[model samples]
Target chain A: MAYIPSMDLVPGVLKGDTRAVARLLSRAENGNEEGRPALEEIFKRAGRAHVVGITGVPGSGKSTLVAKLTAAIRASGRKVAIIAVDPSSPYSGGSILGDRIRMGELVGDKGVYVRSMATRGALGGLARGTLEAVDIVDAAGYDMVLIETVGVGQDEVDVARASHTTVVVSAPGLGDDIQAIKAGVLEIADIHVVSKCDKPDADRTISDLKNMLVLSLGLQPHVPAPLDVGARKAARWQVPVVPTSSVNDKGIEELLKEIDRHGRSLKESGEIVERQAAIAERRLVKASEEMLRDKLEERRGELSVLLKELAARRVSPHYAARKLLTESGFGGDK
Target chain B: MSVAQTKADRIRVIVAKVGLDGHDRGVKIVARTLRDAGMDVIYTGLHRTPEEVVEAAVQEDADVIGISILSGAHMTVFPKLLKLLKARGADDIKVMGGGVIPDEDVVKLKKMGVAEILLQDTPPAAIVDSVRRIVAERGAR
Candidate 1:
């Protein structure tokens, strides 16, 4: 299959050509080789957009809140791009219900670019291509990039590591209170939102989250050194549990203000640089691992032969691996 | 070819609704069926224009563009879509349609380069099969 050259696409992407941006994102999602150089070229132009990740249980009104937030962001004269990651069908590797329907009105708006991504069988609720897509949007000069995850609890926490600020969305009466207690979800929240506040139980959910945050923060003092250090510093900015109802457009302004507050806190506290450094580190490590895996897969034939020998008990698995490594020049002259 | 091989080479289809038709229930069902059948389906939610549909198809590199129009505007929408696809150099993308389409218009749509036209009553299984067949034919081409 012939791919579009990075030379042709990178300029268009940098110029904010929507078509070019979409094609580059597709290439990234499919892992096309040409996307790498384009991404590399655009990486320097990124880091301007604020990346926010919103995640919650399946019916927690996450998309509606995203739609509201996108409008609020646009009202402030800032361009926004949304990456809604939906779960792919395990059988077909495709998705049916995307976040597009909830946020359809934003589709035709020039200031907004909405893209739906399927998890593509990735274990994490966020697709493998999500971060890359976010970067492309950022390079295209979007002021904010909101990533909405599939809300499968722990697996979705990867979004926290990907975004500058993570918003954990919950709703009253959806057993979302129980779902939020799943450890990874609550620990990652810089902002806690209790959506569907029109319901009677909304305040209860809000209080429950506040209580949980208090408990989690209380326990942070006992956490180990380096890990607790960031938490202790981040703890200065209290995690606000805001109640919102998209149905009535309630608390949206408050949520937006809280988001701005968090952004400001991160910048003032110098956590923004640290967060970006951590993100870069993670990206580098992931890329290196992928490269090593590809190199090993290229030697699959030799590995399979060794696997057969091991199956026949001719050699132990460890010995076979060591011999293969040595033969492949990876054992460093041993 | 094995089922695994066929699935690995999954067909990517964009199931779109053009004009002001809000009756996407059928299209959604078809999208689900095609997805279940192992084709990557991108559903451009309701009220899309022909230009938007073609642009999305081009960017997505979709194998098929299935337009589900219920608004009696199929005559205008389908031809406009064909023209847009040709103008954008995306004539290689197969076009299909369903929902409230009459029998006589079906022939016109086919002549205008629609790969298949399913009536409102067409079964989900048939929709899935026709898409697979059309994509296979395109592959042969």
Candidate 2:
């Protein structure tokens, strides 16, 4: 059988065909240059999925929690797609994507799709394919899209900026911690999950997180200046620390309910617009950086030509920079 | 999540075990060999059924499904996986296996659409070359 061209994959993807979704997703992950147009189309058809980002430390039970959360979401009769990200080998550029093992028998379910990603040279707990893969699943008609990060510590906040709702999972007995490595991670969460609530130290973990949230909120109370009374009230969200245990299915439903509630509040309070705007800005900047990198790779010869001209005292740096950008199609002829 | 993919069409294979293949040292070695050869290998650990294996390969969009079995269930395992792959419209993914098996059985399995099966004595380097040839052959088609 011949390969299905990337251009021909868009229709089936738009209609939620699992085969097409799987194929297009592989192309996106590989950064296939042929799939760019189809990706743009996917971007247009997205925005319906409730993309929730879940991050935590290595032993925080993030995968088990994601598996449990997928079950809860599916129980509600919704379609889901999970992008479980693991790190790639920097030396070999090959990876064993074993996230499917912890996903707990989710295979063969038409309503749920689980994909394991390798962060091929991508930093901040995400692969470069992550953002596009989310859009592909979103256009494929999944009601919920869950992104499980590479069990991050502080400064892996890319998941927070990339998601509509960020849930940070902090397990008990992780260490004697000043609230899970202090503010960089704690401040990014729209929801806090204290996993292994069945353990003896669970309460302390919960209380520690609660105290940190309160102290942090007090330190920077209402940083967005002042809006009207209704807007301010709508914008203000009290990030709840939900305790959960995948062991006995404890608090899973409450976590799902809180997720739903957060989704609704964002919509009702008009904060979804602001959140989407911020996400779009981030996407724009990321795309620009990627394109610039690609252009530089494509125009290495042009750079050397400019060097030759400069060595001969023929052209200035400013003129040469503009010439390269124009020739590389960054800006219109001006 | 297959950023597990195409940095210049690097071969992606799902190396798995189906049924009660209680031992896995060979499979683990083969997975590492393929990875060391610059291939992305999704190793689905022991106790997988044909349905589960096919589902994984389809979802992962792998170019091949390499089953390593030593429990003397190759006859039942390979045919069923091929059937499931066909039913799911993913027969495009090549299927192969390795374990202790007789030469005549290898012929029959090959006839039944198993791409290539390496007996126990086959080498690690040959295994890597076979996979590369298999994927390269598929591309040539």
Candidate 3:
């Protein structure tokens, strides 16, 4: 069967058709070529939603925190979409996405849309299709888009590059405070949340995070280099460590406020535009790489012949690669 | 909006447990089996209501909704789910189920729009084959 892009998909997505939105995301996740035009149509309508990324170690209650945050965002009369990226099973290429279980409360709410995406071997603790899915949700007019990573510690920093505000989640009693410092999650955090703060050692965890933040800030405040020459010099932002216990419903309101405060700071510092530009750059680079990969695969027979020649010591590996590049029209000059 | 046609890609399935059933060992295994068969399976975790399950099926555009209920609430959960799916115009989604269901209840559930019911003894490969057959039947329609 010839693959035909769904004719109504772009229109249906704009009309807030949930099924169409899901279909579009599936196409992107599977790397379907037909999804490109739909994405192009959706991209112009994006950039309105605030994309927040939540990442933490497994069992840090990241899903619970996301559920609470979604509720809080909904309470403010804004629509929210959540993309929970789960690790895929290497044996089957399938994922047991249980994040939605913790987020059960938000299931029937029309204002909330939750999707579970598989990492599909992208290896950066996020599904390769996440950015496109976010764009689909954004175009569908959601007010906030929350991306919860697979939370494999340092590898989750990809979310920092993809989101406007990256909230790093942690919990007490797991030694995550030290782990966070060691894993450098503290460096990428716009807001650090210590979930399950009702535990006996919650206070100690909170204090540990506070001390580490202070030490890190004093030693060397990690900041991305400004992309633009006229970027505003804003005040030094303090990474607030908020203690939250979802069981007790404690500190959720404070956490929301801190997120808002960080958003405001980004806007005031003119960093939001810079961040969006960086995200766009990343997307373009990824798309170009994917196209190059596809082209190489289309020429797999020739590439295999070149590889065999190199393996037989008939030609240098670099020379074969340059020849292939030139033949593929990518080399600047022959 | 026009009905979205099924792509030639892998079939998508949503595996869920409704009501207070916390025993998900059976459903998790089924989900893995379907996924290994090259299907995209979305497991909606545990303790979901019929409404939540139907909502997920609709939002996911799943070709199948496989429920694993061990709480013996098959009569309540299955019928309610059928009614909800009908009400939401999601009749195209095929519903299959398993996990400790009585023989009599399985017959009744089939009459109430449940497509297939696997018993506890059904092998994982059989479950995968059943899903493929159901998806193929649906696509043919």
Best by DockQ: 2
Query: Which window of ten consecutive residues has the lowest lDDT sum in model 1 chain A?
Result: A225-234
Candidate 1 backbone collisions, by pair: none
As for candidate 2, its clashing pairs are A117-B1
Clashing pairs in 3: none
| Candidate 3 overall lDDT versus native | 0.79
How many clashes would you count in candidate 2?
A: 1
After superposition, candidate 1 runs with Cα above 4 Å error: A1-3, A176-182, A225-230, A292-334, B1-11, B18-25, B45-63, B80-94, B120-141
CAPRI quality of model 2: acceptable
Which runs of model 2 end up more than 4 angstroms from their true locations?
A: A177-180, A222-235, A297-334, B1-7
Q: What lDDT score belongs to each candidate, Candidate 1 first?
A: 0.78, 0.82, 0.79
lDDT of 2 by residue, B1-141 (tens): 122322555677898888877789999889888877777788877889899989888887788999998998898999999999999888889998999877899999999999999998998999988988888888721
Which residues of candidate 3, in runs, are more than 4 Å off? A1-7, A180-183, A221-235, A295-334, B1-8, B104-108
What digit string (tens of lDDT, one per residue) describes model 2 on residues A200-246?
99998999999887775665545542212212332388889999999
lDDT of 1 by residue, A12-43 (tens): 88888877787678777766565687787778
Candidate 3 TM-score over all chains jointly: 0.88
